[model samples]
Target: MRIAMWSGPRNLSTAMMYSFGARADFTAMDEPFYAAYLKATGLDHPMRDAVLAAQEQDPALVPLGFVQDGTRHLYMKHMAQHMIDGFPLDWAEDCVNIHLIRHPARVIASYAEKREAPRLADIGFDRQLMLFERLGGLVTDSADIRADPEGMLRRLCAAIDLPFDPAMLHWPAGPRAEDGVWAPHWYGAIHRSTGFAGPEGELPELKGAEAEVLEAAMPYYERLFAERLKNS
Candidate 1:
C-alpha cells in the first residue's frame, strides 16, 4: 500500500507519520521533496540545512522506489503548500492520499510559536485553499482525528482499502527512518509521544499583526474548508 499524507504545518502530519511507521510492515518517508524543494527554489525555509542533510542521509531510497513500483506499503508525508512548485501528482496513482487539516487559527498559532513572525499570509493560505479545493476527493479532513485517532485511522484505512491495524496507534519512543534530520526541534513532541493524545489546551491567542493576517485569510479558508467537510 502506497500512501501520501498531505497537510499544512503544525497539523500533526509528523504524528501521523509516526503512527504509520509503527506498523511492522510499513516504510515511511517524511517530506522527501522538502530538501529538493529548498535546494531548487533557494527559499530560506527554517532548518533548510537540516532538511537537506536528511535527504542526503535518507536510506529509504530503494524502498521508496519499490513503493512507487506499486508493491510495498509506503507512506510519504508532505505539506500542501509545497505543491506550489508542481510536485509530480502522477507518481502515486495507486497510492492513497490523505489530507490533514486543522483550524486555521490553531495552525497559525502553532506556526507562530515555532517560527519568527509566522503568519497565514506568509504561507499563502489562500493558494493552499484553492489547491485543496481542486484536489477535492483526494483529501481527508483530519480535524476529527484529534478527538478520535483510532476511529479516524480506521476510517482512513477503510478509505484506502487497508485493514485497520492496532499497531498504528502506538509508535515506539524515538525516531524511525525519518528522524534526527530535523529532530531535537522540528519533531520534539512527536519524537517523544507514543500515540495520539486528545486535543490538549486552547490554541494560543493570535494578537496584533498575526491576528490581522489570520483574519484576512479566514473567510476564504473557512469557505474552502467547509466545502471539503461537506463533500467528505
Candidate 2:
C-alpha cells in the first residue's frame, strides 16, 4: 500500500511525515518533487540552489518509482503546488491520497515569516482543492490533528484502510534521512516537537492583500473542512 499525503505550506505535513516514519512498517518520503518544482518555476525560495541540486529535477521520478526495492506501505509527503503546469499527474491515481488543510489565515501568517509577500497560490490552497476535486479522497485538517492527534490519525488510517499504529502519535526529536534539503530553513519548530501540540491561539490580523487572499480561500477550505474525518 502507498499513501500520498497532499498538503500545502505551513501545514502539519512534516509532522505527519514524521509520525508515519516512526511506524516500523512504513517508509516516509519528504516532498520528493520539491526539487522539480524549484527547477521548473525558478521560485527564489530559501536555499533555492541547494534544493535544486539535492534531488532529481524530474517531477515524475518520485511517484513513478515510489516504492523502490519493494518497500510496502510508503508514505509520500507532497505539496500540492509542486504539481506544476507541465507535470503529468496520471501517476497519482495509483496511490491512496489525503489532503491536509490549515486555515488560510494561519497559513499566510506562518508562510510570510519565511518568504516575501505571498499570494494565495504560494500557500497551495487552490492547488489542494483542485487535487481533492479531481482525485476524490480523504481530507484532514491540521487543526483537527493538532487538537486530537490520536483520534484524528486513527480516523485517517481507518478512512484509508490502514491499521492505526501507536507510533504515529510520537517520534524522536531529530531529523531523519527522508527530510527535504530545505529542512533546515523550514523544519525548526517541528524538529523540536516530539508530538502534536494543541491548537494555537488565534493568529493576528491579515493586512491588505493578505486579507483578500484569505477571504478568497475560505470557501475552498470550508468545503474540505466539512469532509474531515470526525474523531468520534
Candidate 3:
C-alpha cells in the first residue's frame, strides 16, 4: 500500500516519516516535489542550488515507487505548498492520502525561526485545506500524535485497516538516508530525538507580520482540525 502523507513544514512531518520508516515493510520518501517546487517558483529557499541538483526538477519524471526489495508500502512525506497548481497529482489518486495538520500559531512560530517574516502562503494552511477538499482523505493532527504516540498511531493504522506496528513508536536518533538535502536547516529539532516530542505546551506568541500570518491561517487550520481523528 502507498500512503501519501501530506503536511506543511515544521509540523513533525519528519518525525512521522521516521516513525513509518522504522517499519521494515515501508520505505519513506522525503519531499518528492521539493526540487520541482523550487524550480517552478524560482524562490530562493535555503539550499536552493543543492536541492535543485539533488532531486528531480521535472515534476513528471519524479519516481513514486518503492525501491527496496521487501518494501510493501511507500510512505511519501509531501509539503502541501510544493504542489503548484499545474503540477501533477494524478500520482496520488492510487495512494491512500492522509492530511497532517498543526495549529497556525505553532506553525508560524516554528516556521519563522527558519524563514523570517513568513507569509500566509509560506505556512501552507490554505493549501493544505485545498488539497484536503480535492483529495478527500483521513486527517491527523500533530498535537494528537504527540499527546499519545502509540495510541494515535494505533488509531491511524486501524483507520486505514493496517496492523499497528510498535516499531513506529521509536526509531534511531539522527538523520537517515532518506532525508532531503534541506535536512540541515529544518531538521535540527527532529534530528536530536528518537521519536515524536512530548505534548506541546501553550502556543507560541507572535507579532507583526508573523502574527498577521497566524490570524490568516487560523481559520484554515480550524477547518481541518475539526476533521482530525478523535482521541478514541
Candidate 4:
C-alpha cells in the first residue's frame, strides 16, 4: 500500500508520520516534494538550501520509482498548502490520500511561536480550498484521529484497506532515513515523542498582527473544512 498523508503546517503531521513508520512492515518518507518545489520555484522558504542539499545527497528523497515491490506499506507526509506546483496531485493516483487539518487559530499560534512568516490566509485559502474540494474523499481530520488515535488508526487502515497493526502506534525514539534532513531544527519536540498524544485545547490568545491574520483566515478555513466534512 502507498499512502500519502496531507496536512497544513503545525497540524501534527510529523507525529503522524512517526506513528505510521512505527509499524515494522512499513517504510515511510517525509515531504520529498518540498526540496523539488524549492529548487524549481527558487522560493526562499525557511531552510530552503538545506532541503535542496538533502535531496541532492539522497535521490530517494525525491520522487522516483514507486514502492511497488519489497515494502508492504509506504507512507509520505505532505503539507497541503505546499501542493501549489501540482507535483503531489500529479501522483495522487499512485497512493491513497489522507488529509489532516487543525483549527486555524491553533495552527497560527503554533507557527507564530516558531517565527514563521506566512499565515494560512497569505497562502491563498481559495487554493487550499480547491485542493480539498478536488481531493474530497481522501481527506481526514487530525482532530478526529487525536480524539481516538487507536480507533482512528483502525478506521484509517480500513479506509485504505490495510490491516490495523499495533506496531503502527509507536516508533523507536530518534530519526529515521526518510525524516527531513531539517528534522533536527524543525521537529525537535516530535522526535522526542514515542506515540500519539490525544487532542489538546487551543493555545491562549494570539495577539498582534499574527492574530489578525489568523482571524482573517478562519472563515475561509471554515468553508473548506465544512465542505470537506459534508463530502466525507
Candidate 5:
C-alpha cells in the first residue's frame, strides 16, 4: 500500500512517519517534494541550498509511483504547503491518504520558534483543508494521538484495514534513512525521542501576527478536527 500522510509544519508528522517506518514492512519517504517546493518558490527557507542538493530538484524526476515487489508498503510523508501552484497531485489518487492536524495555536507557537516570522500560508492549514476537501481521507489529530497513541493508532489501522503493528508504538531515537535533509533544522525534538510525547498542555498565549494566524487557521482546523477519527 502507498500511504500519503499529509500534515503541516510543527505537527507530529515526523513522529508518525517514524512510527510507520518502525514497521518492518514499510519504507518511509520524508517530504519527497520538499526540494521541489523550495525550488519552485525560492522561499529562502533554512537549509535551502542543502535541501535542494539533497533531494530531486526536478519534481518530475521524483518517483511517486509504487512498485510493490511483495508485501512491502510505502509511507510518504508530505507537507501540505509543499504542493505549489503548478504541482501535480494526481499521484495521491492511488494511495491511502491521511490528514494529520494539530491545534493552530500550538502549531503557530511551535513554528514561530523556528521561523521568526510566519504567515498563514507558511503553516499549511489552508492547503490542508483544500486537500482534505478534495481527497477526502481519514483525518487524525496530533493531540489525540499523543493522548492515547496505542488506542488511536489501532483505531486508525482498523479504519484503513491495516494491521495494528505494535512496532508503531516506538522507534529508536535519532534520525533514520528516510529523514529529509532539513532534519537538522526541524527534527531535533523528534530525533531525541523514542515515541510520541505525552498529552500537550493548555494552548499557549499569543499576540500580534501569531495570534492573527491562529485566528485564520482555526476554522479550517476545527472542520478537520470534527472529522477526525473518534476515540475507540
Candidate 6:
C-alpha cells in the first residue's frame, strides 16, 4: 500500500516520516517533489542547487513515479503547495492520501523562525485543504499526534485500513537514505529525536505581516482541522 502523507512545512512532517520509516513493513520518502517545485518556480531555498541536481526535475512526472515505485508500503511526505501550476490530482487516487494539519498560528510562528518571510502558500494550509477535499482521505493534526502518538497513529492506521504497528512510535536517530537533500537545512531537531517529543507549546507570538498571513490562513486551516479524526 502506498500512503501519500500530505503536510505543510514545520508541521512534524519529518517526525511522522520517521515514525513510518521505523516500521518494518514500510519505506518513507521525503519530499519527492521538492526539486520539481524549485525547478518550476525557481525558489531560492537552502541547498537549491544541490536539491535540484539530486532530484527529479519534472513536477508532473515525480508523483506518478513515486506511486509506482513498488514497496510493501510506501509513506510519501509531501508539501501541498508543490501541487502548484495546476499539477494533476488524478494520480493521487492511486494511493491512500492523508492530510497532516496544524493551526495556522503555530505553523506561521514556527516557520518564521527558519525563514523570516512567509506567504499563505508557503504555510500550505490553503493548498492542504484543497487536496483534502479532492482526495477525501484521513485528516490528522500535529497537536493531536504530539499529545498522543500511539493513540493518534492507531486511529490513523485504522482509518486507512492498516494494522497499527507499535514500531511507528520510535526510530534510530540521525538521517536515513530517504531524506530529501534539504534535510541538513530543515531536520536538525528531528534528527536527534527518537519519538514524538511532547505536546507543542503555545503558539508563538506573531507580529505585523506574519499575523496577517496567519489570519488569512486560518479559515483554510479550520476547514480541515474540523475534520481531523477524533483521538481516542
- Once fitted onto the true fold, the runs of candidate 1 whose alpha carbons sit more than 4 angstroms away are 56-71, 92-94, 121-124, 138-141, 227-232
Instruction: Look at candidate 1 and tell me the lDDT of residue 95.
Output: 52
| Residue-by-residue lDDT tens digits, candidate 2, 1-232 | 8888998898989999999989988888898888899888888899989988888898767566577436557889999988877787787888788999999899888898988768877888888889999888899889889998998988888888899999999988877878988999999999898999898897769989889989888888898899877788
Query: Tens digits of per-residue lDDT for model 4 on 121-176?
Result: 33445455666667654556667777778887887777777888998778777777
Q: Evaluated with lDDT, which candidate comes out highest?
A: 5
Q: Write the per-residue lDDT of candidate 5 for residues 1-232, one digit (tens) a residue.
A: 9899999999999999999999999988899888888988889899999999988877776764445537889898999999877687887887898999999899889988997757888989999999999888899999999999999999999999999999999999998988988899999999999999999998899999889888998999999999999786
Model 6 ranges off by over 4 Å: 67-71
For model 4, the superposed segments whose C-alpha errors exceed 4 Å read 56-62, 68-71, 86-88, 121-127, 227-232
* Residue pairs with backbone overlap in model 4: none
Off by over 4 Å in 5: 64-70
**Model 6 TM-score, 2 decimals:** 0.96
- Where is model 2 more than 4 Å wrong at Cα? 68-71
Q: Write the candidate numbers in order of decreasing lDDT.
A: 5, 3, 2, 6, 4, 1
Instruction: Summarize candidate 1's per-residue lDDT along 40-149 as a digit string, tens digits.
Output: 56778777787777663232232254343235477788666655545555554555655666667777777777776665544556655665555544444556776777
* lDDT of residue 229 for candidate 3: 93
**Could you tell which candidate, 1 or 2, scores higher by TM-score?**
2
Q: For each candidate, C-alpha RMSD in Å?
A: 3.9, 1.3, 1.3, 3.5, 1.3, 1.3
Q: For model 3, how does the per-residue alpha-carbon lDDT over 1-232 read when each residue is reduced to its tens digit?
A: 8898999888889999999999988888999899999999998999999999999898887854434446478899999989879898887887789999999888888887898778887778899999999989899999999999999999999999899899999988888988999999989878889888899899888988888888899898999999999778
> Candidate 6: what lDDT?
0.86
Lowest summed lDDT across 10 adjacent residues in model 5 is found at 60-69
Looking at model 2, report the run of 10 residues with the lowest lDDT sum.
62-71
lDDT (CA) per prediction: 0.67, 0.87, 0.88, 0.70, 0.90, 0.86
User: Which 10 successive residues of model 3 have the least lDDT summed?
Assistant: 63-72
Predicted structure 3: lDDT: 0.88
TM-score of each candidate?
A: 0.82, 0.96, 0.96, 0.84, 0.96, 0.96
